[model samples]
Target: MSPASTAAASAGPSARRQASGPAFALTAGVIGLCLAASAVPSPLYRLYAVRWHLPTSTVTLIYATYCLGVLASLLVFGRVSDTWGRRPVVMTGLSGLLVAMGLFGFASGAAWLFAARAVQGLATGIAISASGAALLELRQGRDPATASLANVVASALGVGAGGLLGAVLLQFAPAPLVTPFVVLAVLVAVLLLGMTTVPETVPRVSRSGLRIATPGVPRQIRAPFVVAGLAITCAWSIIGIYLGLAGTLAPALLHTASPLAAGLAILALGGASAVPPLVARALPPAVQIVWGTLALIGGIASMAWSLSADSAVLFVAASVVIGIGVGFAMFGALRTVGAAAPPDGRARVMAAFYIVAYAAISLPAVAAGFVAQRLGAEATFQIFGAGIVAVSVGTLLPALARHRAQHRAQHRA
Candidate 1:
């Protein structure tokens, strides 16, 4: 055998096996819980509006506040996970979630809502980067497919459960608004305590006297970055509309109007999104991207049809379609970027990708809410759905043409 192959073989299966045990599960749990708390309030926006007599547009603004917090935190400390180690930064993020939840449980006005969302955003921003990096590091030398699958599944479950658990808490608990956050805060504290059990995946002092700065992309990788960024943004924009506004829009659109039911619309997407990666193990990134685009087209079309026809069933179906698209696109983008990214520029490239993603979720949805107020809600939704479809289709056609052209050139040669 070659020296490199021989060395790899000599590394021992036992050591590779060690990384996948209890410690990894503990780490995944902590990260998943952190993400869950970030979305727990998604279902509660209606309660806040009812309690405060605020407008739906106001709720979108409140949701937008969370994005702002996430953006600020990412800008300031997105690389902290790389520099300071993932565990400590994650623990800090969880603590932020705990504090945010406490504030939200007791929130009475717009200011409190804004503060809670900001805290949640900051907490999520910190946890997401650290958790993802840590999961990758911990799974090094193991099955890359398994590691990616775990992260994607955990993210889906966490987001889905956030809405369902919050909705159930609101539907059944006494003082629903106050109770869910209190429960989530306590759960976060438990996760926080559990953090001590997991070993740090990223070691301290790796900087070796280097000054850590904002993340960047290498010149050769820029093309992939642009395609990955656009695909990612388009994919996540579907989610932005679902989780950010579905709570308010679903009731009116589907005529259910119950906050709990509306929460299910978002939950449906999250739940359905989680299932695909399990079956699609080891899919190539490019293939996953194509599937994602197609799914987005189908999902958005279904949603538009649902709105036009006033069928809740179709709305639910649309959620599933979109969820599948998100699952494929997100994982595809992650794998593509991670592979294409040179070590030196990985962080910056990832930072830019996330900025686009969160923008997809926050900006367009906020715009939809205002448009709904003026143009009528159904018309506004159609516009949102149509616009997303166009973007997804627009993104897909050029890529497909390029892929075919490349294939033809290769065959001709």
Candidate 2:
């Protein structure tokens, strides 16, 4: 056979991997597993601090380290799967995570944790990038919006489940820190195995596309991408604050400091995140953005007052509102990006989107940790709340003004 004929013959199989109906859910499960595994350390951060005599700033650094690893991986390996094939990259990343679990389980001090988390983050970034793009390709006959919704819902539930799983193990297991990741490892293994059954989604990969580079946005989507980036940056900043402080807030205001109690806020918030996407299944992205931003601003305001007044009910209520807002806002924004993303460049765009998302989640929380140490959690949270409101209003107002002007012009026509 001619070289051209040989290449064409081989290309047929490498080009497309027809997915079963279950592959869609399974792909989303991979994203969920990545998210859940990342949180396995959250409930244990307190344990690490107490056992190691580490300061709050250092604990926050450990958390930030993971985000840093994720960012670095996204920048470098984000597009590797585009050339390397999603199946191999996903499997490789999962193996890295499995090793990270071992590191976390055997860690002797702060340094081990930093190493473990960094490994965990890098692995997660690659896995999430591959799976996210896989979701787009695996949609089969489904709309891109459905795939986006699945991604949001899985992330929400996975985070809640991870925190709760960690806390439960901590509260009941004989050895807290060691037990959580061991259990998590088993879950990761199962998911890793399940992935083998899912067919590869990438069309064809070549050695030339293997170079390390930053994930890039296509110029066509850059405008909507910025608007989407603003939406998530605003929403996730508030989430980062909540995640950083919820443990302390539970004890200070609610008077419950147990490991189980500490995880409740995250669990509740994460659970609430899944609700909006389900309810707003048919809601337009624009409407979702407006309603979601409004909910976030109101929720944060209510939460700030709840803290000052020591009203646990109000705080819980606000958490629900904020969580729903996260669901809607993130879903709306990501859905917009997904729709705009070119099929071939989907993974790169998604990786760029995550870079923005993780930075928003990481930077603000670290800043809040420092502020809270100096000002106290309640006061720090109030300041945090105000900042979210400011960003939300700044984001919401211009969109609203432009929307109104567009509507009037349409009516005049």
Candidate 3:
């Protein structure tokens, strides 16, 4: 039997007994909530910068700090859920999330913001791994494709909602920073209650202790893994640029002082991101990657031109295009990797994938902040946009070549 079959067989009677009802939707909702909470701070980052008189470099470091915490969690506890039951691990993550939300809501200074974000990252990292695995196992008919699509949609919605909600609260609510987090805290509490009804998909197994190791891709799938990693990394790099810098950048580049404007820009990027997965659900993964990469390249280039020309119309258009490109490319990469992994190793494989992807998301944004401090935001956008274009083009080549080879082989047969 294949490894996936072997893993399913290992689930035994306990797994079958627990596999009834609407667990898929519940798990997916939990995933969405976790991601939304993570994004709640996007609009607030610029406000924090203004309130604390923080430099761009300091702001980026604060953002990257969260990613560091996530990396640490994934490296240490990524596979812990595999040994323990998924529910316990998920609940633990949610508890951590609550603490993070409380910290953000009550934050008084830079230290509080940094600490809150780190805790948020740790909580999100843990929750994402366990929830993603649970979704796969709890999915109706064990459809990996549908599960992957749900994951992508949930992520996009979470990001968009978080940014828009933060914007609205900041504009009208009494306490901008505090109110958004308080709202998220309440939402998370509700999600925690809802999680109680979801079934545990991973059977509890006796293990000696926690196993801490680096997440690794199996040797057989290394080629596709590299392609997927590159695709996701490139796509996330674009997203990181927006998340880390858009709020700050939008005001300066577009000459707008409104927080709502900044928030809407992010919301547009995120909302547009959700479109591709629904539109291209039936396309082959390779086709999706190629088209997505092309869109990424074009979108970045358009943004660069828009910045130079000071065209809000072009900038908005670019954001939408970039969003669609990222959504398609990332979803395709995730589906490819998830489908290739054995059921038992899916979480570890996903953890490994995200470690690389998040690194791409965090590190470059921090670097760009330092560069923007000295060179100016306009120059920085040009430089980062060019780099993204190059990377996307480079990533597209191998995927297209492989697709062509597969087509040729099929034709010959």
**Clashing pairs counted in every model:** 3, 0, 0
Q: Candidate 1: global Cα-lDDT?
A: 0.72
For candidate 2, list the clashing residue pairs, or say none.
none
lDDT of 3 by residue, 106-191 (tens): 88888887998899889888888878777666542455577678788888788778877888898899888889888988888887
Runs in model 3 with CA error above 4 Å?
Answer: 1-21, 140-142, 205-210, 252-255, 405-413
lDDT of 3: 0.79
Candidate 1: which stretches are off by over 4 Å? 1-18, 208-212, 253-255, 343-348, 397-413
lDDT of 1 at 270: 82
lDDT top scorer = 2
Better of 1 and 2 by TM-score: 2
The Cα RMSD in angstroms, rounded to one decimal, for candidate 2 relative to the true structure is 4.9
The deviation in Å at residue 174 for candidate 3 is: 1.3
**What local lDDT score does residue 174 receive in model 2, on the 0 to 100 scale?**
85
lDDT of each: 0.72, 0.81, 0.79
